[model samples]
Target: MISFSPTEEQQMIVSMAKQFASGEMRKIYRQCDENGAIPEGVIDTAWKMGLTSSSIPEEYGGPGGEHSAITGSLIAEELAWGDLSMAMHILCPALFAYPILEMGTESQRKKYLPLFSDEKYKAATSGLIEPRFGFDPYSLSTTARLDGNEYVLNGEKCYVPLAAEADLLLVYAAEDGTSHAFIVERDTKGLEIGEREKNMGIRALTTYELSLKNCHVPKENLLGDPRGYDFNRIMNCSRVALSAMAVGVAKAAMEYSRDYAKERVAFGEPIGSRQTVAFMLAEMAIEIDATRLMTWEAAWKLDRKEEATKEASLVKTYADDMVLMVTDRGVQILGGHGYVREHPVELWLRNGRGFATFDGMAIV
Candidate 1:
């Protein structure tokens, strides 16, 4: 039986996240988005919440609280409700730590997992989403060829979040017709990072393009050892996280438009009282709720160690469309004000447009 109810701990986590989002993140999100930079203090406060460390095993220098995918989805929605770019910046470490915890060898876990537990925010990111048209994660353009004790990587990757500041990167590539991830240190030779990308949305979160020209790493850096790892599962987790973020952005647009419609006068009455405006708001709410439920179901399956590839894809596709529609409608409902900078609906709509291509920008 599926239960939608949050446990006591999950409720507490949600409350805490909500408080932070409403009080801190929401206040500064606009400024950060405009400046194209997130404040270090924001990242520090979020890091102190232990969103990443609590999941690591105590033996591996963590809080021993264990990972909960469903709880994580809830928290992600709340944080993203505050701000998308800041949420990604704050949780960027998970893009590195979770994969290691899930698929790394015992030695690899011992060597790298402890780095995420420090008191300050440490950027550890994942390298996926290459720079090319018609990209597929399963058949990465980045190739890792074995040369005795080291694997030589050759390809270019783009949209890597926090690349400039990350202490380490988990770069995914194709090896012998199979997908695998390698742990690459920040200072690897022959790895040239491009200038920060100026994108249409999520601008506050810095992304970079990387050229790995014969960048060699030790054979031991291959995640999950000789048997390889479950790349699909990791992809599924990413899909769930992205879907949750879509829900957050959509919910924000819907609520803001709804409130504006209620207050703004039209023909000597509130616009929300009209049939067209009321119906649009209702549809937006329905879609947001539906998308969130799909995300929760996918997360729940992941928590149970069940395969959620199809479900994840389902939610991601639905959310990608749903967010675009909801945000566009939000702009439409607001008429002229929606397109203006003073309101955030236009910003939300711009950000929503990129959801179709936002792979590896975040993880759960």
Candidate 2:
């Protein structure tokens, strides 16, 4: 018995998110992309929406509410619909806070959770993707070795969002052939912050390369209990979130192209009336719907505390293909206009290309 409808509360959040996306994010996305930075005002405005605060318990100095992956997925889709890079920037804190809330020790939660729940938006991020070809999360190039009561970390992490000003970083590495997340403070010795990466897409989001040279942290910094937290679960949440983002980006491209095709006339006929254009739009719509359903299903399973490894992987793989296909079709439909910088279809296509490596950019 599976229900695909959103709850009342979920609907409300989705509506609010959609408004924010359409009004604020869409208005400034291009400028930010060209500038290679999201304005602080834009981020602060989203923060006031209580995206992070509402999830924390009242006991932890937040407006009490449950953290639902389905709701998060809904919200994420709308936000990314406005702009992918800004959406990632707005949600970066979750990359650090959600993992702690999900599997951190009681003390860890008490220490770190409140930071996110505070009145102002806090900069916190995660480091997972390493600088190497054929990177795998399960088989990390980064290594963590226990020495006495502390763990020593040795690795280079790339594409870490908000790394320049992030107060806290949840660095993932392999220890005894198992993935583990370590909470490292920004000022920790031997942890060097590299220059901001000039990425192919999502350029508005500030990402950096990091060099960890014999960095050490107390055993308490390890997330979860002695048995260790479920790394797979975290990865699943990340996949679902990324899948939702792909849906948003694809949806935006589809709608824009659809509208363009209807209005643009060639030889006194709307291009959309032609069979080839109509069929391509139809296929794009079908692919987007299929991918959205898969993403929502994975998010639903995650909210119920069920294993969603397969579903998450399925949606991620499907979305990886769907977004590229849809955006490419959008560019094709728009002809010369799509290739120009004034139009967003090319930008969407560029952002959509990074779906293959979007592992730790988001979490739910």
Candidate 3:
């Protein structure tokens, strides 16, 4: 009993974003990859478009509506079609905003939500995953202890996106042998950022190691339960973004493969005329349709107050893998061109890899 039709307002927002992303975001996407710096201007346009600030509260001077997933998913797919790396960079503040919106105190929300609205201030990196811990949020080598109303944290968090440039950090640590999330601002005395890890794709967003040496944080910065505070809203907003990203990437790859198969002559006729090539595109079509539906279903469930954790994981798992399949076939259809940087299938392949293991892919 759910509907995915866009309201007039939502449709207008999507159209406007599509226009802006096509015109402005596309131009900078390749430049960012070439220069190895995800510029602020690309994301500034997204913020002006209200893409990242949609998670903040409307009362806090943000769009902040509860039903942002549809619009967000729409934009994510489109942006990924333009450039996956730049789309991810534009969403940096968004990833941090989820934890705050779900777990922040009024003061914390007031303090950080405005940062997203500013279009200039980038937020912090999330220190959730560890080299040893992986996605198992409960198991941990990191330790945080309360001493005289100040929390002393000691840990090393790795693969943290945007760690080099993050202004604040949300570190997950164990206190009294129980896991807790700590809010550590940038420039803290004991916190040190490591070199950026060179990812296979999505280089526009940086990942690095964070060494927290006796990092002391105020008691008030604690977000939710050390062990119990999971932003377990099943319509998990982060994965929602990822699902849309996959759909966008897959859509583009599918189009490329289909077009290439049609024009590339093989055995006197177009390869697309061949049963094998046409079937490949056909399979891609089916998977893309399914992926889009799953994403829409999860987003739709999220826009309502419904149980969507299962649906979200399903979408994440299916779309995460589907994008890879579509893109790989896209490369196959293109033969040699797919392997080269001239085509974006390689980047799509790289982008799809990160998402494959996220959102409980191992468990699923």
Every candidate's lDDT: 0.90, 0.91, 0.73
Best by lDDT: 2
| Model 2 ranges off by over 4 Å | none
Quickly count the clashes in candidate 3: 2
Pick out the ten consecutive residues of candidate 1 with the lowest summed lDDT. Answer: 224-233
Residue 102, model 1: lDDT of: 85
Model 2 over residues 1-364: C-alpha lDDT tens digits? 7687898998899999999999999999999989998889989999999986788877767787889888888988999999999888889999999988888999998999888887688999999999999999999989999999999999999999999889999999999988999999999898999999998899898999999999989989998995548899999999999999999999999999999999999989999999999999999999999999999999889999999999999999999999999999899999999999899999999999999887975468
State candidate 1's TM-score: 0.98
Q: Relative to the unseen true structure, what is the C-alpha lDDT of residue 50 in candidate 1, on a scale of 0 to 100?
A: 88
lDDT of 3 at 222: 85
**Which of 1 and 3 is ahead in lDDT?**
1
- Model 3: weakest 10-residue lDDT segment is 355-364
Error of 3 at 291 (Å): 1.7
As a whole number from 0 to 100, the lDDT of residue 101 in candidate 2 is 87
> lDDT at 91 for candidate 3?
66
Instruction: For candidate 3, list the clashing residue pairs, or say none.
Output: 179-226, 180-226
